[model samples]
Target chain A: MSTAGESGKGVGGLSTAKRRPGRRPGSADTRGEIIIAARKIFSEKGFDKATIRGIAREAGVDPALVHHYFDTKDGIFVAALQLPVEPAKVVPLILAGPREEVGERLVRFVLTMTADPEAREPVIALMRSAMTNEQVVVMIREFLTAAVLNRVVEALGIPPVNMEVAFAQVFGVILMRYVLRLEPLASIEVEELVQIVAPTIQRYLGGD
Target chain B: MSTAGESGKGVGGLSTAKRRPGRRPGSADTRGEIIIAARKIFSEKGFDKATIRGIAREAGVDPALVHHYFDTKDGIFVAALQLPVEPAKVVPLILAGPREEVGERLVRFVLTMTADPEAREPVIALMRSAMTNEQVVVMIREFLTAAVLNRVVEALGIPPVNMEVAFAQVFGVILMRYVLRLEPLASIEVEELVQIVAPTIQRYLGGD
Candidate 1:
């Protein structure tokens, strides 16, 4: 009899899949398992060395099963981070506020997301990976350019010529404080930091 | 009998003792050769994978010669980059100006250093290497803290508690614009960008 747990098994005997069969059993569950495994393996070994087979083994699925969920290693990586969070979810909220207030919202969102202990590790991992892994770096660069910075440019209605430089200024501030953990910026209260930084971001995003 | 370029041949030979004919015959020349080789190898293989033997081979000197010049891989790295220009050299210049003017000077220094096409590659390589190598990262963080931001804190006469956060904000802005290559920032004129960002950095560094 295939019990809820048994249904999770694959090429490996007695799969280590964390989900019970009670959860929907299609793409979603399989995808989730791959993500959890990838995150673990990527964190342990880093991007260059972590293999697909290792992720598959950890997830308790066949190598093919892992591929079925994610078409390639990069695909698995993007899925693992739950990244490329749709701008649609964030852009409207930022735009809904007054033009001057956009910087505050943007700063708050980034700080809140990165400040969470649970969320911090994945971001740090992704950044570390992006430095070493060419494909991942390209993907991250593209996503940052297209989804996050582009939307800010659009929302602010800045000239296309100015968009790139402005976004660089805003993103640079976040990267230094959040990823590099530079002093003063890292230790400051978020509200205080935001109050000081937001206006510059707003000016960059909105225009002179 | 010894000439500068001919002595370079000794630098290219793989045997350490053979390469050293006269008193300190090839020491300075050998060190220079090693640095050139190391820069090429490091740029190609990056910091993590580039080996001492590979650098020795490229320099045409024995591995011992490479070690003689630099005690460890990091010693070679720091020497190769010639990055001993710490905050002590740069920071006081930043603080020397009026408080309101400090941000512009700080941003100008970073942007100017990075914007130069010749200097840009090494800075980028340093950033990428620091992300992957913990030792290098710690060295960089400490240097930036002690030499740059801490001085700013002292100059401003703020409590030590406040220095870290202030540094974070200022460095954050610099990193985003320079390292990440964010839009508008990467594209914008340095002077324009400096004008816009300086006040905020000034505020974070010392402004009320």
Candidate 2:
């Protein structure tokens, strides 16, 4: 499946439906283009410093068009970092599989989703922004808490803290591998890493 | 027991012995002061953009003084991030205890080192610099490879890749806890976390 197309289409439908004033009528693709620009600018300048006008200029659209498309920078960020498959949507798929393999599925999902640069950029952008900006950190924390972590914790019926620590370990490995490009970890085969990390993740999921 | 003094004294003695021209003989504390300033500037401006003159200006010393103390920007970076104790020095300390407990010691060392704002600043500075600057990433990768990681791998006799994976997990935990300050993980008590994480670290250190 075209994850990229799915991600864009999902947001595009939502924005067009909102039909905020000044959203150009014929510019069906305007929202998508603006999102592209937003991701770029936000990644470069981070969350706090990236201005709406700058994103609009990058998209070659007016500032009003940006406002029409996304109400606030936070709105744009939610849209920009939001992946094609929602955590809520994917969690059931993950949960439907064998109970014991959930950890492997989760590990493989993140590693595979972020395996490519095109798909990885938005994730990295969100993480990097969260790292440097306190405002963005809160927003991201709220987003993940709602969309991903909390859902997974509830599904497994595990302690939230345990799930968070599990996520932190895997999340850190991903950042080091993809973002920091740390050696050995960066170059190791995906399946090999999955094997090494999956068991620890399993323990985190259900271990005593 | 003063890590700050140890870090300063170690560098100062080396700088004075190098005896580069403009090395002010009377300025016994010049190396330490420059490191403090370097940590601040590198953290704020990042590694590639941070300049010797800028560091000197911040430290209220001459640019030549920075040059005398540190032969290159890389040198200052190494000195700045280099903790009070070297890995070579600490590896034996970590290895001297019960073999199974090494993981606990290593995990505790990193968590405790980064817990303090003053001690954590240089580490966070290096990590933040590494995140944004490719040059600094390579420099840091090399430093950790030689000074800490390689030594740990040697001591444990684990596959280098396994050792790296282990480090990445703990390293990521530290980044989230201290730098990003991710919730729950951030607030979780150190010993509590040590209990939660030590087993995983042990498995990485010794498990097949």
Candidate 3:
């Protein structure tokens, strides 16, 4: 299936793309290098200023190859951040279920995504970075608003504040459970957390 | 009230205590120095291991003077972290009001505490440090449990999990408002925030 980061001719016709000497397109970790470059550029320039050409140049690959792997700047940003789940994908999934149950679905999705150690690290890393780096926070806010919050609001007919508060609660749980690791909260069963937290989130989302 | 950092004669007797050469105990910012030392020690050792004597020695001040200014290890810790309010002071206030209004009181307390930029910075800094530093996380977890969460639970007669969840929501609001500065949530009026969030917190705290 030619996994996300393995040797293969580029999907966007970068088969003959020139690169720095001694590295073939088919052998080296082209995708990985691109992500590394994207991460650095994003950190330095934030989500808005970082560009495909810049990341491609930093990675020593053709820009087309960058596009082949990650279709848009947001895609590259998602890859660079190593997000647990794509906001583009998850927003739809969250919205697909009955509107009243949006809280349950949203809570379940995040808890499930973060339950795995591998899936959770990047988010924690991004959040930690966001705490100190105003640039990262702005980038995340823009990306999240664009990719997730705006879509949900448009589809569900809620004010922006509702989503923000709902997110704040979920964000707090993730921080408490994973980062701060406050007891009982940290070790509590996922079902228990969802049960306790979901109704409030529902109220925030769908309330009068 | 003597400003917390200002020089004053020790409340505890340390009139003739010896210290490292070149700094006078009565004339200098002894309280501030002890807090600096306490911050360093707490960073190095989790809450249980840090001691008043260790912080005093690190500050090149007498332990009695440290005791004079801040009466207990927890007091020193609260000062070192530059927390906006004393959990000790705040907890009792949160409990003193009608039990149903506890959520509103809590929401108001945190919103008011973090309203000041100077006050919020330390908390954000502590949260940022906690994300990367295991020692800091452990220290915070222990201290918060001792000074705040446990006390709230004991007085409210709710399961500890209820307080944890309530705290999680408040914690999330703080991070969202001050750190991430997510819009609507960040800029919403305090009264509006209290209205929207207090009910949920009240539910969390006093709900069946």
- How much is B63 displaced in model 1, in angstroms? 24
Residue A129, model 3: Cα distance from true site in angstroms: 1.4
Clash pairs detected, candidate 3: none
Cα deviation of B140 in candidate 3 (Å)?
Answer: 1.0
Instruction: Give lDDT: candidate 1, residue B33.
Output: 72
Report the poorest 10 consecutive residues by lDDT, candidate 1 chain A.
A1-10
Model no. 2, DockQ? 0.43
Candidate 2: clashing pairs of residues: none
Q: Candidate 2: which docking quality band?
A: acceptable
Measured against the true structure, the TM-scores of the candidates, in listed sequence, are: 0.60, 0.71, 0.85
Query: In DockQ terms, which candidate is top?
Result: 3
User: In model 3 chain B, where is the ten-residue run with the lowest total lDDT?
Assistant: B1-10
Ranking by TM-score, best first?
A: 3, 2, 1
Question: What digit string (tens of lDDT, one per residue) describes model 3 on residues A1-208?
Answer: 2123433343434344445553335424677778998988877776767788999888877777777687778788888888877777678878896878988988988898899999998888888888778888888877777777778888888888888888888888888888778888999989888998999888988755
Task: Tell me the spans in candidate 1 whose CA falls farther than 4 Å from its real position.
Answer: A1-80, A159-179, A206-208, B1-81, B158-180, B206-208
In model 2, state the lDDT of residue B103: 78
TM-score of chain A of 1: 0.59
In the range A60-156, model 1's lDDT, one tens digit per residue, is 7667666655656666766777654345467687778777677788778766776776665666666676656655555555656655666766767
* TM-score of predicted chain B, candidate 1: 0.58
Across all candidates, the chain A TM-score values are 0.59, 0.66, 0.82
Model 2 C-alpha lDDT per residue in residues A116-146, reported as the tens digit of each score: 7777777777676666777666656665666
